[model samples]
Target: MRQTPDCVLDRPSVDDLDQFFSIVSDPRVWTHLPSGRLTDEEEAEAILVRLVFADRGLTAAQLGARLA
Candidate 1:
């Protein structure tokens, strides 16, 4: 886990959905990404689920370390 003066860098989890949604739902946050800002909570939820739980071959700890 890395900590800067302003924030900590770590793997995100399901519990972080609300905070994650708050950030990504903002239009400015998606300006450089391939897609536009998420339109609603349901959309955000689906995306987060796939990202955190889908079988991408990495174990949870491996995923967390890479993300961190």
Candidate 2:
């Protein structure tokens, strides 16, 4: 895990889904992301699932490529 004075960076888990969704659902957060802000809970859940799989070698980029 990496930390700075303001925040810490670490792997995300199922428990973080709500916070993750809250953050990503905001349009400001999508300024550099490939997709636009998520419009619903279902889409956020789907993205969270892919992120969890990404930690286990699937890689988010690979998942995004397939999604694209």
Candidate 3:
């Protein structure tokens, strides 16, 4: 895919948002956390709802090194 590289790489650009969630939220991709807790889909969905639609400007990476 092509990107203009204007928006921050760590943050979601409008175009890459759907593709990013499709990857990161996939059960097969997000396995055990470093703490060994498995992520649930409902939790992922809620997070996406908040971050993507709610216009919370914080990038997921800003949460911590783990998600980064």
Candidate 4:
């Protein structure tokens, strides 16, 4: 039988900050953001904090990314 994992997924831990930076650091994803590319690591960290903090009611927001 096929099963699904229905539990809510927790936010990625701080140890994964580099992965977070890769997302926010890209200018394309920041098209709606004022700062284009992330200011730096600290700024990227802040964005992560906010994303997990804000209750924008998205099961998942579709931000763009490219995997190489």
Best by lDDT: 2
Candidate 3 local accuracy as lDDT? 0.53
TM-scores, one per candidate: 0.60, 0.63, 0.32, 0.44
Model 4 lDDT at residue 19: 86
Q: Pairs clashing in candidate 2?
A: none
lDDT over C-alpha atoms for residue 46 of model 3:
51
Candidate lDDT (C-alpha), each: 0.76, 0.82, 0.53, 0.63
How many clashes show up in model 3?
Answer: 0
Residue 52 miss distance in model 3 (angstroms): 0.5
Model 3 TM-score, all chains together: 0.32
- Sorting all predicted structures by TM-score, with the top scorer first, yields 2, 1, 4, 3
Write model 3 residue lDDT over 1-61, tens digit each, in one string. 3456674345544456456557665666646644333346555455655565446565556
Q: Give the range where candidate 4 is weakest over 10 consecutive residues by summed lDDT.
A: 59-68
Q: Give the poorly placed runs of model 4, Cα more than 4 Å off.
A: 1-10, 46-68
Model 3 segments beyond 4 Å from truth? 1-33, 36-38, 56-68
Instruction: For residues 8-67, write the lDDT of model 4, one tens digit per residue.
Output: 655565566898898878877888885677759998775675565354433333222111
Worst 10 residues of 3 by lDDT: 33-42
